[model samples]
Structure formats: structure tokens, C-alpha cells
Target chain A: MKIAETDPFSFKEMRKALFFLTFALMVLGTWMTFFYAPTEVVMGHVQRIFYFHMGTVWAATVAFTVVFVASIYYLVKETAKWDTLAYCSAEIGMLLLTLTIITGSIWAKPVWGTWWTWDPQLTTTFILWVLYAVYLLLRSGAGGRGKKARYSAIFAIVAFVDLPVVYISARIKRGISPVVFGPGGGGIDPAMMQTLLVVLLGFTLLFILLLRERIRIMNMETALYTRGR
Target chain B: MKAKLKFIVPLVIIAFLISWLVFAGVRDSMVYYITVEELLEDVPDVYGQKVRVSGTVVHGSIKNELDESLQFTMADGKEKIDVEYDGVIPDIFTDGVEAVVEGSISTDNIFVADLLLAKCPTKYESDEARYQRKKG
Candidate 1:
């Protein structure tokens, strides 16, 4: 495992393979969403944005979950690799979450007739975004490497408590956000669901590819800094 | 393994406490966006609590009262409520359209709303679609 982490040959080859896979899947998913999926009877072409919107959200959730787990593992093992994993995942999670919010706002303007609302789902997601953004700032501002890792791990765990709340907010009866999944709800067209699933898979692959590259970049930066010092 | 378990137990307890706190927070802050019928069915004691209710604006029941205030009757096909709001209404708010009003019910059986929101009806033609239709 250490060899795999530090050795350049196999890791670089793996990243290369993931890069191609991510690219291919992304193109195919986008094409499927626009061409294969039927136009929604309600929102028309704007409704097609749901695929990308949901894809990024799910991808962000996956990244955050990794952050949470890696944080916990880092706390237990006190390993730099685990800390690096948590940091990279959090960075990627924040990027995907930003996309999710942007796409959600765009979708809301046409369907909800408003670009923003303080509904439970939206509010919680916004809070999570802020929390993660602060986490990144805290890590960067902390001077020592050990202090940065420890503080960031704690923040990652604390911020993750909102994940379940955000996921279920739309399903709550009082939640004004649209419920895409519930009893008597989430009855999506089969083709639309297929497109969403494909896009989600593509996004997940893209996330993995990005995470690997980020971790590699961070490792190089740390080595360079240490040598400079 | 033993050392890890020692840390894990306390973390698990802390996580449990945090989850409970979240549940309580959500329950306290939740304000259901219910229809007029649901609001009517709710106990009268709930009148003063902050809540959100939704219904179709009764045709011709809207009056722009003094100081940008509105007095309107909204119905859910079964029940209706008189709503008094003091604010700029949403652009999509109109007669027969569904609107969600947030605030509380007053003792006088009027919904005192602080915020108003409306979503465009789903079946309506989008702007792009309308433009395409005109060009065709």
C-alpha cells in the first residue's frame, strides 16, 4: 500500500486510465440526457438540468462521506495519508457542492419562480457549504502541518452531521423544496431515471479521478515545501 | 485495536448526542406548508405559532390595501382563509394561482403573512418554448 501511494509509475498509469474513463462517461451521459431522455411535460428543456443537478449533488455527497470517514481514520491512525485523503476529498466535495447550488438555483428560477429560498433543504445545503469553506480556510491558515490536519479532521466530522439532514429535508412533509423521492412521489419516467443514474455514475468517476490527481499534487507540494525549508 | 476502541466509544456517544440535537432543532423549526384545509383542521391553539400555508387566491378577492398591504381570500377548493400581508407580493402571484404564505394566524381568524411565494404552474409553456412557437 505504501509503495502504491509513493511509487509514481503505477499511480500515474491508474490516473491516466481514470482520466479517459471519466471523459468518455461524461460525454456519453450528457448526450444521453439531452437526446435519449424524453422532454418533461412540465418544465420542458429546463427540466433536463435535473440530471446534472442531481449528479453533482450525489457526487458531492460521496466526496463528503469520504471526508468524514477519512477524518475518523486519520484521528485514529494519526497517518498523514489519511489526513491527505480527507483534505483532497473535502476540496472536491466543496467544488461539487458549489456546482450543485448553482444548478439548483438555475432550476429553481424556472420551476420555483425564485432563485433562492430558505427552505430546509436549501438552507441546510448552504450551511454545509459555508462550513466546508471555513474548514478549508482553517486548514490553510493553521501554520503547522500537524495542527492543520488535526483541526481539519475535527471540522470534517462535525460538518458531516448535516449530511443526513440535507438528504431528508426534501422528503419531510413540511419541506417546501420539491420532493423527488417519497411515497406517492419520485415517480420519474424510466428514461429520465436511466439518464440520471448514468450521469451520477459519470460524476462519481470524475470525482475519483479528480481526487487522485489532487492527492498527488498535494504530496508534491508538501515535499517541495519541506525541501525549501 | 484497544487504543482505537477507547477513542471510538466516546466519539460514538458524541455522535449520538449531536444527532439528537439535530433532530430537536429540525422539529422546533419545522413549519409545514399546508393547504387551507389542513390549516383549518389544525387546532385553534396553533393560530399564533409561525406557520406557512398554501392555497389558490380567490378570484377578485385581492385588495391592495393601504401602505402596500394586501387583503385576500385564498381557498383550497374545500376551505378558505382571509390573509392579510404587508409586503411586495411575488411576481407570479395572481388570482387562481397557488401561493404559499408564511407567518401566523391571528386571533381574528386571519392569516397574517410576512412572506409570500409562488411557483409557476408546471404545465405552462416556458419562455423558450413560447419564443420557438412564435418563430415557427
Candidate 2:
């Protein structure tokens, strides 16, 4: 394969394509997450958040996984690109995670008697939010690239591994998680299941697009750093 | 390179389009609500699936395992159903109050509620939020 040149300001046709596709995906995802799924007769309309919940959580899972790996890779390789990728992934993931919390809270308020709960998963997600907040803080502080990558990577790896377990136990472990496995008998109806699938797919596609754009940006930034030196 | 979204963008779009297709296949599995009488009429269809059952709390049927859990039987004049819950019973859940349970029924005929909701009569307001207006 041909080596990529070091260029700070770069654009790619393929990347642009991906962005457009992602735009389409966002449209499709919103439609499916909102419209395709059937409303709960009991919960009324607010249950729509579950579809968004699934989508954002799925994106969060991928982002967390990337954070874990990139952290390790950055530590070992001490490469700028890996750290950059980790930063981008975490930033975007946290944004989606924030959406998850917001939508989840609104969904819960009317149904769960409050907007927040004391469940392990709910608490963990809150903690993850804090950790990422720390990550952002550390990134901006006056440290060389080496120390920044070393510490943040360690935190990222630890946090990523714990996210899923928290999700499962919280989702399935009744009396333990806020809503239990199936609050509202918490499982999906056939119509709902159908809508949820579409939303999930649309979001998946959107993720692919976003991920590509982020990676490209990382690559371009890496090129500039090498060129400067 | 011509700044164009060529093969790269199309592949991504196609992937998302495919996900939407998969969702379409499973959408029919979604279900809806039916009355207790309707549920009784078609127990086989609703056996162990989620649903919303509405009725009055059978006046004397209230049982508080409220120490550990709470159980009660609800009826819509003609049909009676049992409900058990293990969370803080909403303050509004009491005798003669109207309630709606969101959950499924078991083979033995108890409603395994995941959510319990109740509405109080006369909309009590000894002390109320800014949103309430007191009666003269």
C-alpha cells in the first residue's frame, strides 16, 4: 500500500461520501426509532425513548470498545494517531451517552416515579460521565503527549470493560437495576420489536459514517504533527 | 482526487439501508393491549406476554406483603385478576382506587406487573405544588 503523505488540511472524496450517507442514516434512524416502533398502551408515547435508548447504547458500546483498545495501543505504541483516535471516540461516545441519559431520564420520570434511579447501571453510567469529564480536563492540562496518553488510556481501558457488564446486570437483574429487566413487563411487543430493529440498523449505519469521518480527521492530524517535526 | 463521495459513501449508506430492511422483517412481533375479559377470552394469545390490565382494586382483596412485596386482586366488575409487586407501592395504590398494571399474566392466572399505577379520587390537596389550585 502507498504511504499516506503528511498534510494537516486534507479532504477525501470517500470521506465526504461517508458523511452524506451518515446524514441519510440519521434521517432513517430518527424515523425508525420514532415512527416505526409501536407506542406502549400503558406508557403511552414516552416509551419511544427505548428505541433511542437501544441505538445510543449500541453506539456507546462501540465507542467504549474503541476507547479500550486505543488506550492500550496508544500506551504501547506511543503513537499520536492512536491517542487522537481515542480522544475522538471518547468525545463522540460521551455525547451519545449524554443523549442516552437525557432521553432515558425523560422516559423514566413519568413511568419510574422519578427521572433518575439508584440502580447500579444508572449509577455506573453517571460515573462514566464523570470519568470522561476528567479525561477532557486532563487532555487540556499542561502535560506532554506521552503522559496524557498513558494515564487517560489506562482509565479508558478500565472503564470500557465495565460498561457492558453494568448494562447487562442492570438490564436483567431485577430489584437491582432501576426498572428491572422488563419494566412495563419491560419487554417489547411484536410491533415495537419491529420498529426497534429499524432504528437500531439506521443508527448502526450512522455510526459507521461518523466513525469513518473521525478516523480520517485523526489521520490528517497525525500527518500534520509528523510534518511539523 | 476529485472531492467526491464515491464508493466510500455508497457502501456506508447501503449498510444502513440493509439494517432498516432487517428491522422491517421483525416489526410484526409488536403486540398491543386487550381487556381482562378480552385477555380471558384469548389467554393462549397473551400467555406470558406483556400487556396493560385496567380495573378497580377489589375492595377487600388488597394484601400487603408490602413489607417485602404487595399483592392484590383487581376486577372490572366481571373479571378478577391477581397482581403482585415488590417495589415501593405508589402512595396512590390503595383500596377502591383505580389502577392500571403493565405486565403479563402467568398460566396460573396472576398478573406479574412490572409497573403499577394508580389515580386518587377528588385529587387530594392538603398541601399542593404550585401547579395546584385549592377548592373553596
**Steric collisions counted per model:** 0, 11
Proportion of native contacts kept per candidate: 0.16, 0.00
**Candidate 1 residue lDDT tens string, B70-105:** 889999999999999887666556788777888998
Q: Pick the candidate with the highest TM-score.
A: 1
Residues A141-182, model 1: lDDT tens digits: 938878788878877888898899887766663655666555
Stretches > 4 Å off in candidate 1: A1-10, B1-4, B32-51, B56-73, B76-78, B82-98, B102-116, B119-136
**TM-scores vs. true structure, each candidate:** 0.78, 0.57
Lowest summed lDDT across 10 adjacent residues in model 1 chain A is found at A178-187
lDDT of 2 by residue, A1-229 (tens): 2334444235665566666776776687677656765555445566667778878877877887788788767766677778988888888788888888888777656654456654446765787787777777777789777877777876676555446545644444322233323453334456566666777777776766777677877788778988999
Residue-level lDDT tens digits of model 2 in B1-136? 1322453355446545644443343233322234567767778778898777667788888887637777998887888888887665554467776666778888988888887765323221112221243333
Candidate 2 interface CA RMSD, Å:
14.6
Q: How far is candidate 2 from the true structure (C-alpha RMSD, Å)?
A: 15.5
